[model samples]
Target: MNENRRWSTRENDRVLDEIAKRQQNLRKTIQLNRKEESDSVCLHDKLMSEI
Candidate 1:
């Protein structure tokens, strides 16, 4: 019974770690996308002003 419990605990820890890593990656992706969008907007504005 104790061994089973230990195995379950390890599995739970691994699942939690994977979830955390995915969340971090998602956050980084969102940040990068936002930066790209903002840059595009700035470039658009600059082009309009030049015209």
Candidate 2:
């Protein structure tokens, strides 16, 4: 019974770790998308100015 409890705890830790990794990746992706969006906006403004 003790062994089973230990296994369950390990499983929970593993799941939590996976969730943390996914969250980190999602944050990185969001940051990159925002940067790209801003860059495009800057480019658009530049083009408009030229015209």
Candidate 3:
């Protein structure tokens, strides 16, 4: 019984770690997309001002 409990705990830990990693990746992707959008807006404004 104790061994089974230990195995369960390890599996839970691994699942939690995987979830955390995916969350981190999603956050980074969102941040990157936001940055790209802001940069595009800035470029558009600059071009409009020149014209």
Candidate 4:
């Protein structure tokens, strides 16, 4: 029974770690997209100013 409990705890920890990793990746992707969008807007404004 103790061994089973230990296995269960390890499995839970592994699942939690996977979830954390996915969340981190999602945050990074969002930040990157936002940065790209801001850069594009700036470029557009700069071009418009020149014209």
Q: Which stretches of candidate 1 lie over 4 Å from their true place?
A: 32-51
Local accuracy of candidate 1 as per-residue lDDT tens digits, 1-51: 999999988987886676567656656667758776566557556754764
How much is 15 displaced in model 4, in angstroms?
0.4
Report residue 51 deviation for candidate 2 (angstroms): 59
TM per prediction: 0.58, 0.57, 0.58, 0.57
Instruction: State how far residue 18 of model 1 sits from its true place (Å).
Output: 0.2
Kindly list the per-residue Cα lDDT of model 4 for residues 1-51, writing each as its tens digit. Answer: 999999988987886676567556656667758776566557556754764
CA deviation > 4 Å runs, candidate 3: 32-51
What is the per-residue lDDT of model 3 for residues 10-44, given as tens digits with 9 covering 90 to 100?
Answer: 98788667656755665666675877656655755
Question: Looking at candidate 4, what is the lDDT of residue 29?
Answer: 69
Lowest summed-lDDT stretch of 10 residues in model 3?
Answer: 39-48
Model 1 vs. true fold: TM = 0.58
Q: After superposition, how far is residue 11 of candidate 3 from its true place, in Å?
A: 0.4
Error of 1 at 30 (Å): 1.2
Q: Residue by residue across 1-51, what tens digits does model 2's lDDT show? A: 999999988987886676567656656667758776566557556754764
* Model 3: residue 16 alpha-carbon error in angstroms: 0.3
Q: Which pairs of residues have clashing backbones in candidate 1?
A: none
